[model samples]
Target: MSIAVQDLEAQVLGLPPEDRARLLERLIASFEPRSKAQEAWMQLALRRQEDVRSGKAAMVPGR
Candidate 1:
């Protein structure tokens, strides 16, 4: 690999978690921003987690 690319990668790695996540989200969203859909799914997932935790829902072993 090129030294310039390697140095850039090192700089990126040095970024804080929040900064890195923001940069990554922008890069991916360049293709298409599904932020709303992502938020909706996250909310639904959290609700499902709460349901499982409260025994409002049950899981069974599967093969």
Candidate 2:
């Protein structure tokens, strides 16, 4: 990798967990269309919702 990219990677890697996650969110949004990602998420959510409703799955309480 080029020096500039290496430096950037190091800086990104140094970010705190939350900062890194937020950065990742922005990176994905930049490359992926909002509607496409939203559609995928919605599909997964609906399937999970139906699973619980149909008694095929159950929601676990978060600690």
Lowest summed lDDT over 10 consecutive residues: which window, candidate 2? Answer: 28-37
Model 2, span 1-63: residue lDDT tens = 457988899999999999999999899879977687799998999999999999999999999
Candidate 2 CA-lDDT value: 0.92
Clashes of each: 0, 0
Tell me the TM-score of each prediction against the true structure.
0.44, 0.50
Candidate 1, residue 54: the lDDT equals: 100
Residue range 12-59, candidate 1, lDDT tens digits = 899999999999989887897668888899899999999999999987
Q: Rate the local accuracy (lDDT) of all candidates.
A: 0.90, 0.92
Q: Model 1 shows how many backbone clashes?
A: 0
